[model samples]
Target: MIGKRYTVPVITLAATRRDVYGKALAKSRTEGLLPVVVYGRKEQSASYFVALPDFKKVYREAGESSVISLKTPEGALDVLIHETGKDPITGEFIHADFYAVEKGKALRVSAPIVWVGEAPAIKLGGIVVKVLHELEVEAFPQDLPHEISVDLAGLETLESQISVKDLAIPAQVKIIAEPDDIVAAVAVAKEEEEAPVMDISQIEVEKRGKQEEEGAGTPEQGDQTSSP
Candidate 1:
């Protein structure tokens, strides 16, 4: 999925129906368009294409979790950016999948965790360790948050920690992650060990010894003899 929360107004993207079996996919890309599919719980799947630049702008704001309106020839459909495929080499979005949101139905998604504030433990020579980066939650499309904020100020000591239960989530949302799971913690920083120094004199002696051994195995130029 590609969106965050519905903090901003719903974005409207113009879409045109596409031929799924046609050879125009590559041609569409060259024309600055992105191929996409829209499907819903009860709605039949349909293929379409939207302007690449417009889709990129929407993706930046909506991500995979936010709802956006797709204006097609048939009608306008509210959908979420369910998934996307990118070119491995160029990193360009090759295709996208939009999941239509059913009215009054709840959606399950992983909301990103954004760390805010500074941990006091850092002043005490302790480092902060984050365990989880996202939280699994269920909420209506309109109620889904773009991101959940985690306050690092709670970590005052090396032993102090934050868990999923400590998050400040909306009343309309239900957390699916374990309540006891650690989200972030502080730990005492470990000192790096110094690397041992080597003796240059010993290396020179070993090299000389190897040279002598090789020299002893070969016959001198003046000592060459022919066999009968």
Candidate 2:
């Protein structure tokens, strides 16, 4: 399932050129816009603003690997959503960076891994441990895939494992990882250890001893201080 190719619709996002500087960036967000920048191999970087709702929809569909058409005032530019910034507390989009795709050039990006099918080892009381969530790959922007699917059915036994080399990658894409690197593996689940039991009698004895020691240091309740 590694090299498998699937067709994905070309995703497009609308953006407007933004010249806002300094404190104005906050104003853009208040108006339902997100500040973003676009740059490429030999292209000039430019700042722009995109609708928050529209950008969110495109991000969900294109992710980081897939190329999307960014419709700007100048023209439509083919780009990839390279990075994003968010409001830590509110989880709202604050900014984004888009990588303009250069035609005829290969781009190195991380492709997310999608697990397909249920591992047979899981039914046998074995747990599947995923080691890699994404693979670093290089391919032409047009050949880039939204994601790489890894079939879990290959894991039949608890000892079964999948390595980087086991992935069936597309002919155009090259994986930038060690061939022997384990991608996923199945292992026997460990039994939960029992909690240590406390000795109630020993605890009670220590508490009583502490109380008696404190009482010995105090004078009798009826005793009065001797007059000097």
How high is the CA lDDT of each candidate model? 0.86, 0.90
43-86 per-residue lDDT for model 1 (tens digits): 89999989999999999877876678899999999899999999
Highest TM-score model number: 2
Model 1 local distance difference test score = 0.86
Find the 10 residues in a row with the least total lDDT in model 1: 1-10
Q: What TM-score against the true fold does each predicted structure earn?
A: 0.76, 0.77
lDDT of candidate 2 over 1-228, digit per residue (tens): 355564557789999989997787888799999999999877799999999999999888779999999999999999999899999999999999998988888889999999998899998999999999999989888888788889999999989999998988887788999999999999897899999999999999999999999999998778689999
Error of 2 at 7 (Å): 4.1
